[model samples]
Target: MASGQKKKWVDKMVFRAALRRWAQAARASHRMELSELREHRTRARRLRAHLDKLIHVAEERLALPMIGNQAFPRPVDTDWAWRPELWCGPLPVPGMSSVASQSMLGDEATMFHDCAQSELTLRQVRNTREADLAAYGLRMDVFRFDGSYLSLAIDLPEEASRGLKRSHLIRIDTIVEMEKPLEIFARLNIKHGPNTEQIVRELPLHEADINVEFDLAYTKLNEKRVEKLWLDLIFEGPEMNQVVLRDLTFSRRKRAAL
Candidate 1:
């Protein structure tokens, strides 16, 4: 072998031996005397400090351009695009069970339901698929949903409504997987002065890439009074199903004037 390759192989073997020694020490730590245990603990803590830093850096580096990345295709003439916080990075609280109505997963996403008994779980998981653009995904498992209405709401950032106008078209793109056939609807709610304009579109689950567009021209949107906007993903007949949302993105573009 070349000198460089031989050196690397030697270093790898040394690393493996060191790790095995540490593992043996850990396994025998329970039987160690107090003095020896204290000494070992001190050394272990020092080693762990360096190992933790290494692991953190390695994980961040391995994630590459996925974490905190918001790059996605935008429609022609599009001026704004956004991916929710849940899909961009890890959440402080990643998973929840028996989620209550209006429970929020992150700063931007919330779950709502009227179920008498909460048999649901929501988790933010890493997306490892090669084609997944977002670093994270959301999984929802519903064992027995007894509610009449269920929806996961994502509040848009302020940028989405900034410089708002009536001639813009908003679009939603989602990568979703389901354990079984389920009907889902995308609802865009724009809250203006004392009024909320809503446009709902059923997702084409049959398609591989689900995309929906909402033309603001049809809504009675008071562009001047536009304050906040949010999107609601409503699920129909969601009982006993597992749904994974791999990625979701929103974009806005101006429509040609008549």
Candidate 2:
């Protein structure tokens, strides 16, 4: 046989000898060895259970349509869409996305009650019912209101920094359910450098008219100076009202130039 083959045979023989010695040692302590083997098997079972749970979690995560950590779903349009309730998460802050006795409006949103002697609570609710809009909605409960200027403000995405032109039309669609009939207004505010322009529209009483469009062409928008944009949903005679905002969405499209 070749020298290399002979050396490999010798190495295999040495490995077998070591295994035989180990087996003999284990057999010599048969009872203790059996207990150790049983313990190892139990540990393996526990590890498998943990692994199964991890796999389940991973599967659920994969089932979601989110591209990354974004909680909202993607819109069919190629432009931007925002769902505040879903964007935050399942359990949102009580005051902002959720309403509790002492909860206040959440971050990235604000409320003005300069001269109020009332209570305001906001909460985010999961929409389990079938809907094409969002998986979540906001509920705002107001009681004993006494403020001169009252408005709930929500900030838009930072992508607005890209710039907005007079040729674009901002559209807002929302589903509002109120305990009592009241007038609610939607205002779009655009800040450009040192100037701020606002377009206001009264929400129609007809449920079908819950959509509003703001043509930037009608406003003095310095396209290059555009900094940020926000929306304010104002309520009239909102005292002792339970307003449930089922869905809110914003989109932009080029206006058909005249």
Candidate 3:
């Protein structure tokens, strides 16, 4: 037998022996804490029931669409595409509404406010309807707003940091349903060097007005100085409103050179 092969076999045996000892120690600990484990199980069942009831209430009030298995759209010559909501499973912090601003919707999204008297809640709803063609959507409910400004900021994934250039066109597509007619704006922010550039566009009221494209060439984008990218959804007069964002996607493509 080779010396190296013998050493490998001895190492494997030692690992197995260590694992066995650990498992035996774990079993003994579990036996000693069996009563505490039983109490934990009982509490866990109650928590599960409460969570189920909460989900039921959300479905009743929100009436979200069913989850679907459909693909999102992309522009021709697409270099990058991202669907923020459907990128992962359900959000850990599903809903929050209060006077204090927070970022409970995971690391990728944040909500900010400067209102003295207002309430805001954001949650991910299951998309069951086929028309949505997406797995999830964000529902934002607001009331009694007296804020200077409020916005939902979504951090783009790391894929966006591929060194954007002036020749790239960034497109934002969204489906919005509001309880009342309200002015909403979408802002694209790009951080380059020590400066940040912003491009703002008001979302149209009609369903047909669902897309906006930002021409990087129009801005002073230092191609070599590109750092980060993000999007902001700014709401104006959002009092007593329920806004459902059925879908939001971003795509980038090269602009046609004249």
Predicted model with the maximum lDDT: 1
lDDT (0 to 1) per candidate: 0.94, 0.69, 0.80
Candidate 2 residues lying further than 4 Å off, grouped into runs, are 1-78, 85-88, 96-104
Worst 10 residues of 2 by lDDT: 95-104
Using TM-score as the measure, the top candidate is 1
Assess candidate 2 and give its TM-score to the true structure: 0.65
Model 3: number of backbone collisions:
6
Candidate with more favorable, higher TM-score: 2 or 3: 3
Model 2 error, position 71 (Å): 11
The candidate with the higher TM-score, 1 or 3, is 1
- Count of clashes, each model: 0, 11, 6
Q: Model 1: how far is 237 from its true place, Å?
A: 0.5
For model 1, the run of ten residues with the poorest summed lDDT: 58-67
Cα displacement (angstroms), candidate 3, residue 250, comes to 0.3
Residue-level lDDT tens digits of model 1 in 78-159: 8999999899999999999999999999899999999999999999989987688899999999998889999999999999
Winner on TM-score (1 vs 2)? 1
> Against the hidden true structure, what lDDT does model 2 obtain?
0.69
lDDT, residue 222, candidate 1: 88
